[model samples]
Target: MREFLVEITTTIPEGTEPAEVDRRRAAEAVRAKELAATGNLLRLWRPVGELRSIGVWRAGDEDELHEKVLGTLPLRSWMTLTVTPLESHPNDPGKADAAG
Candidate 1:
């Protein structure tokens, strides 16, 4: 599996119904939980007062990450994602832990 760092920004179109937004948000949360259980989602963080989030995810490759994993999100249409592939570093603390 390859790791990716993703920055996600979500926009709700103007004049959309509040209930619809709420429904989608609920669905998105459920989808996130499912991805986490499958080990696709590693971590997620949001900046204070921002409608954006950053997360770490894993998939076979970029295409699989896009087509199979991220493509399945309920809010995919409303999201703009910047995906960066990660490479292992020799000095990474996680690598050290694993070695020890």
Candidate 2:
């Protein structure tokens, strides 16, 4: 699987009810845990002092990543996402082991 860097910014629609926001938030949390348990989600972090999130994910390809991964997010409609593919650096930890 390929690794990807995902940046997400979320904004509920204007005039969205508070209860709806809470519901979506809860659903999002559940999705996160499911992804993590499946080893598709690597790391997740909420940027300090910012309202955005960053995550590392693994997938067979970009299309699968979009469809099977991002598409499954509960807040997909309300979130703007940027995805970047990742490559292992020569000096990266465990690179030698992987190369061998």
Candidate 3:
């Protein structure tokens, strides 16, 4: 599996209904949990005072990550994402653990 760092910024259109926002947020949480269970989503964080999220995710490839995983989000249409492909490092802690 390959890892990616994804930064997501969400923007609700002007005058969007509050109920709609709530529904999508709820659904997004559910979907995130499901992704984590499947080992696709590794970690997620929201920077203080920001309406955005950053996450580490795993996938077979970039296309699969975007099309299969991220595309499934309830707020996909409302989000702008910057995805960076990650390469494993020899000195990575996870690699050291496995070697030991």
Candidate 4:
């Protein structure tokens, strides 16, 4: 399976309160758990910037990733999504050791 990094950017909806931020976070957690159960989620993190959040996912291809993202309501409402392949690092010492 190939690994992908999904970058999500969201615009806060008008009239949303500060407390709604926490609610949205909770919703995201639920979505992550659901994805994990399906063995699609690899890792996820909320970035410390104006951009929304980042999710690392493993899947067969881009279509699968798209489907996964589409399944999340929060993502659909709040995110502009981009998917990119995570390239394996070459010439890393860890890789050399693992091959030995």
Tally clashes: model 1. 0
**Candidate 4 collision pairs:** none
Worst 10-residue stretch by lDDT in candidate 3? 90-99
| lDDT tens digits, residue span 45-64, model 2 | 99889999999999999999
Expressed as tens digits, the lDDT of each residue in 24-100 for candidate 1 is: 99999999999999999999999999989999999999999999999999889989999999999877889978778
What's the best-to-worst order under lDDT? 3, 1, 2, 4
Pairs with backbone N, CA or C atoms under 3 Å apart (clashes), candidate 1: none
- Write the number of the candidate with greater lDDT, choosing between 2 and 3: 3
| RMSD of each candidate relative to the true structure | 0.9, 1.9, 1.1, 3.2
lDDT score of residue 89 within candidate 3: 87
How far off is residue 47 in model 4, in Å? 3.0
The candidate with the higher lDDT, 3 or 4, is 3
Q: Of models 3 and 4, which has the larger TM-score?
A: 3
Evaluated at residue 9, the lDDT of candidate 2 is: 99
Per-residue lDDT of 1-100 in model 4, one digit per residue for the tens? Answer: 7778888777878888888877887887798898788778877788775566687887788786777554465646766888888877886676878778
Candidate with the larger TM-score of 1 and 3: 1
CA error at residue 37 for candidate 3, angstroms: 0.3
Best by TM-score: 1
Q: After superposition, how far is residue 99 of candidate 3 from its true place, in Å?
A: 3.8
TM-score sort, best first: 1, 3, 2, 4
